[model samples]
Target chain A: MGPAVKLKDLYFKYSIHTDRSFILQNINIELNRGEYVVIAGRNGSGKSTLLKIIDLIYPPERGDIYIFGNLINEKNIYEARKRIGLVFQNPDTQLITGTVVDELAFGLENAGLSPNKIKSIIEETVEITGIKSLIDRRTDELSGGEKQLVALASVLAMKPDILLLDEPFSMINVIYKERILKIIENFVRGGKTVVLVSHNLETALNEALNNSLMADRCIIMQSGRVEFDGTPASLFERKAEYIESLGLRAPIAVRISSEINKNIDRNFPICSDIKSLVKQLTGLKGKELKK
Target chain B: MKELIKIKDLSYSYNSQNDSRSIYFRNKEKSSVLNNSFALKGINMHIDRGEIVGIIGPSGAGKSTLLQHLNGLIMPQQGSIYIDGKSVIDEWDQKELKKFVGLLFQNPEDQIFEKFVGDEIAFAPLNFGFSIDDVRKSFKDFLEYFGYEYSFKDRLTYKLSGGEKRIVAFMSIIIYDPRVLVLDEPTASLDSENREKLIKLLEDWVSSDRAVVLVSHDMDEILRLCNRVYILNGGRVVSEGPTENLLFDEALLEDNGLDVPEIVRLYLMLKTSGFEKIKKFKTETDFINWIRELKNHA
Candidate 1:
């Protein structure tokens, strides 16, 4: 019921530049605790920069950020980061250990949890991510999807209240992508906050919309500015314009469904999984047709 | 439609076990770490002179392993590979074939090593025995196409962004003017804008009569570029056919752990909604146009 994180007039540019080539500028938003929030933007729109700032990895040049009602300062940066778990875009950058089991357990150790407690948490997270089968396997030996699951398990094992993941599903195949999505959903349901930076627009946005149903929040960024901040339905109002700012188009499902709904009183809903969207729309068909 | 690259009943595995060197020295008959596993299992594939084929499957499907076989990176254990009417295994001459087939692996860090940006771009042409003058000219042209200012030539490679690193990797591959291009996970880490550029690049390559084989998990990208799709599952080419057939083939796609495109599903949904004629439109533009026409008819 409280704000998990807050960003006020945040501006972050490359450290080398005093110029205006920032990834984000004049950013303002609030993320609630126990929310699964997805921040969508085109590449170079500064979504990752924004996440790094929130996770306390990158301090903003100017602006204010508060974590759990506490203003973040230089002294408490490490403590803030420990409360927020960030699974980097490249698993290689994030996975420092040599093996999956160790990788999954490292974050807990870093969080300074007791060793026995870390073990129990790692066991639970590994089981939830279904990486128990892959725990002993070499991180390099595991497939892309398996490595991605290990990455998620590592972060989840830390049990941070606010989890920040950048392109978490990029390396994964669709099967493992679905599995991680479920685990993330359960974490949010259990009152953890999540902010995900993703290149795959459809899945992250749809999942945030479906279970949360715009109940959390969606922040669409353009040129380092908060272009739109509202529920999914509100963002859908200026779908074309919002997509252009996001450096993408309205998703195929939204496009097709809206197109079909143009001729009828359509719900024009958006969903990530095309198969499930098909089944839902097919259910609305009057009767079985004679093929 | 001549055969460009061919693999016949090939198999391979990694000598990954720690005891392989020590144990093998002590006992020469010790089995390798990849003893039981096969990276590639009797793969038999044929690419025409200019065909864009999409290889799709879940993780650990041997997609990356198969791409490595085109060049001499990893020789096949039990099978033979032929490129441009010559058997690569028996003939043992990929000097020109290496130039013909340019491979871009997943990690940019794995393939890129030069310090300066221009040197990194020129690394390939230099390897192919191009004269300094000739390599310099080719590097200049690719840098121009890649939209790098002249100032970027001396910049450090690691300082470049992820998208920039990938562009340099592509430029390295393209400077040689390879006849066939193989890319693994080209669009995965890129943003939408860069992803669009790479898509356009592939679509153009497909039109240029240069065969391009892609092993990617992005179904939307596969639908857009590839006319033919090869679905690999469990170290085998499980399904290969036209892109239209592959996209509509839900059972095969699902079996291989792939997601069907959203447009196709919406198209099918409109079937019993009294619009059953044009339910197979592939792209966003095509589907939107279908709905535009469906409005008039309805």
Candidate 2:
């Protein structure tokens, strides 16, 4: 019915006793329903802190947060939290139960869903995430990547209106990473909201190009403030000097494209993948045409 | 080149404990464990002084298990390891082992414990019987090399950022000056600028009397830093060769779930698209130079 998340004049600091510097200062942002947003920054630049605040895990010292246009406060905090699901960078932190099935069922059980409904949701989540083989395996016995798949399934079983993933697949292997990205693709295509935080250049590029899951907005944070906010294309096209100064990086294809453009003094469009980049470089429409 | 470390017929597996009373022990699901067999299977590798070697593989391929064997953190179930001409299986003194090989695990939080940064870095060397004056001199040299100010010595280890913590972890290890340095995903948390700085620092380190064994998923780093590489899959060495040659094998790399570097991909795509003039270049600078030459010809 309204923007999925809205934060106004949010200000936060760890505590009054610690250094008085604000950890987050005068933040204002709004995400419409079905929008995909990426928050990128160097470590300790407050990317995780922003996600925590949005999930209401860390309360802002000042300002208002509205989820789906309803202001969040103690009176409605529990109800609001039910509508948001969070998956952390480390799957071990979020996985509670011993087996995958129980882990997926834990959240639904807490929400007081009927047993049958829980079972069906778990099945659907396993099918979507393609973690059917891992459904019965013990969480501790699973590898880092497998644990992340279980974590994603556990969160998706709730069917929350807003999904927040904090560096969700950085430690995962490529095979599981692609499957996880596929799940995210399906979720976003179904007109849901996602806010992903990461510094991984490869995943960002692949998700941007192959899936056409371009971020509606990209926000780069620095020293507890938004240094840059724009489209993903603009973020990748920023000068190397500036991006490096912010302690971030562009994908390798983008980097090569930039160098080629600089050498030729002609703006060859930035291609997120190598195939398209080669196409642009040779000025060929298709592979057959070149042959 | 004489081998500093030799791993022969190494194999390891996690045995399900008979005591299942622990909270983490799920006795019923023991058979369902994804990898019930050897985490590492009859692995063999060698590291020589002044060599930079990279070990890469997909997750669950026993990359970390292989690293743990080099420093005797975990003993080989079936084979032997030799460090500095001494068999690690027969000689299990970690204190003596630390003098020859310094291992930095993937997670810095697991390795760093002292409250202050200076205390954290100084703990190991002091324990190893370094005189106070020697420790002070080494710390000063590290400060100058890493470009850290004197005031940074007082900062708490836990309070530092992720990248800063990794750098400090590296400093803690390098202060000891082990002949062989084993680093697991050293650049995972570092920003690109810091990563570049680390590459240069590693290059300098490996050019001298020290050898470094790096384990990572970053193909670019492997291609840039490592002279030799071993590709592991399912706890076995799938391929091992010079970095340039092994990385160029697209089928081997992709089948192992490793991403081919984008520049290499561009070369292949151009060749596939019938651009006969495209040539393979090893590094970014060479690639850029070739591009400039192409522009000039055009």
Candidate 3:
């Protein structure tokens, strides 16, 4: 069994005001090893704050977060942070280097990787991301998605043990949106832990949600608390209204499949994939329940 | 209904490398968005007075490009647009054209110039030489309608949040009360509650016989507010119809660069999967009611 992430009633807040202000409260989630997870909710639901906490960009006010069986505290916080890579919501904020080539090598330099290996990693990253032509372009000129790819290329060069993304595709064009999803999916398949925070319920379900359906878990935050935390299937299997009531959109597939079950007036699992939903429908009609 | 605006085979193309390179549309080298291409082509669309029309398509579908033409922002290379039967693009003066149709760009930050919030909101009308008294009456009413306190007038415009910036952006046009308003991505970054309010404000504006054109990537918002939707792809109006068609046509939306509303997909799945064969819903509630009927009949 591989080491997994554990949260012990973790309390996270952005400000010092205890009684009035708290970004996240009473969050207890366990992300399994090498799992691809999505934490989704409305804006200000603490999705971004949680990822920032996991990424060690900010400290949790109360409770402990364990990554790979190691409790994150002051002692190991510096060492533990090396394992996490966060592709932030705003690309402009994360960018430190003036040029693309420097950005690709920035994290590796931070990790004290040798110069020879650094050159090889940068080449592989720029080539794989298809940003070789764009390496020389100024940061201000790149479009929304291109900037994100540059940001991602930099992170991948570091080769962190776990990855965290905060609305990584929010500003990009649709073409790059699909491309980043594929890139992130492939990155997860390589056996590195990945957790994402996004308000884009549709993409989360269609792209990463299914890949992490059974093995991985997601936490739905509401009013600064964990509303639902479980496998994707488990979350959709029973509760539909609880999510909808919170002004959060369920995965399109889940809602549609559920609607199918309702229209046909029969119960079935919410399947994100079209093929599986069709199969489920086929099986249901095979029985030919009296119409 | 008054014919607020009209376009007759409107066409426009920009030099990609040379944003300032071309004087005429025909001189542009590219026929399409192949590196440096056409932003719009043969766009023949119109909005009646008081019509709340929606423009939607995928990311690069030229929705914004078409909206820019409505207000005379980018002069067309080869086309004619008539506002109130007047050839606004071909003939009207710049100041007069701006008063009839105010075009609101997506990023409010791009539009902001004045330091104070009040100054920014009042800038457009002031530039049009509106009397100070009229601007005062209109600005106060507009701000109150959107649920903002009067004191916000004193604050710095740039310091406001994304949602607040959008409100200020809309107010800039509304203070002058343009008969035809065009807004791009009106609620792109707003939270759910604020988004609802913004929609309501837009709806009221449209209902006043002051035609409003909304260009949005969020199909759900358009489905709720717009009476008619024009689906633009590759610089042409490939599909234009009532909200029912745009919202229900999942294939048209997805292929054209939009994710279909969940209700539409559900209706589609049910239809294809041997449940029923209905293709439209005016709203989610309407769809829900229809589903319940489907179950009852089953």
The CA lDDT of each predicted structure is: 0.71, 0.78, 0.71
* Higher-ranked by DockQ: 1 or 3: 1
Better of 1 and 3 by lDDT: 1
Tell me the tens digit of each residue's lDDT in model 3 across B1-298.
4678888998876544433221222263442224426668888888987689998765555776677777778777898988888886557887899898888876677688899998888788888999888988888887787766887798677555555677788789878878888988776655444566678877776754678888876666777888898888767889999897668876677677676665565557666777565757756567556655645654
Q: Clashes in model 1: which pairs?
A: A24-A224, B10-B79
Candidate 3: regions farther than 4 A off: A1-20, A25-32, A59-83, A91-160, A169-175, A200-203, A206-215, A252-291, B1-3, B6-34, B37-45, B50-52, B61-178, B190-204, B220-261, B296-298
Interface RMSD of the candidates, in order: 6.2, 5.0, 7.4
TM-score of each model's chain B = 0.87, 0.90, 0.84
Residue A2, model 2: lDDT of 65
Which whole-number lDDT from 0 to 100 does residue A180 have in model 2? 70
lDDT of 1 by residue, A1-291 (tens): 348899888877777656537767898888987787778776556777788888888888889999888888878777877788888776766777766667876666666788778777876887788765555555676565666677777877777889888877675776776776777777788888888876546656654443343335667777678877876556655544456446655555554455555554356555434445466455444322322
Better of 1 and 3 by TM-score: 1
Per-candidate DockQ values are 0.31, 0.38, 0.15
> Top TM-score: which candidate number?
2
Candidate 2: which stretches are off by over 4 Å?
A96-102, A113-120, A133-141, A201-203, A263-272, A284-291, B17-30, B132-150
Q: Which stretches of candidate 1 lie over 4 Å from their true place?
A: A18-20, A109-116, A206-215, A256-291, B18-36, B90-95, B129-156, B207-209, B272-279
Which structure among the candidates has the greatest lDDT? 2
Judge candidate 2 against the unseen true structure and give its global Cα lDDT, from 0 to 1: 0.78
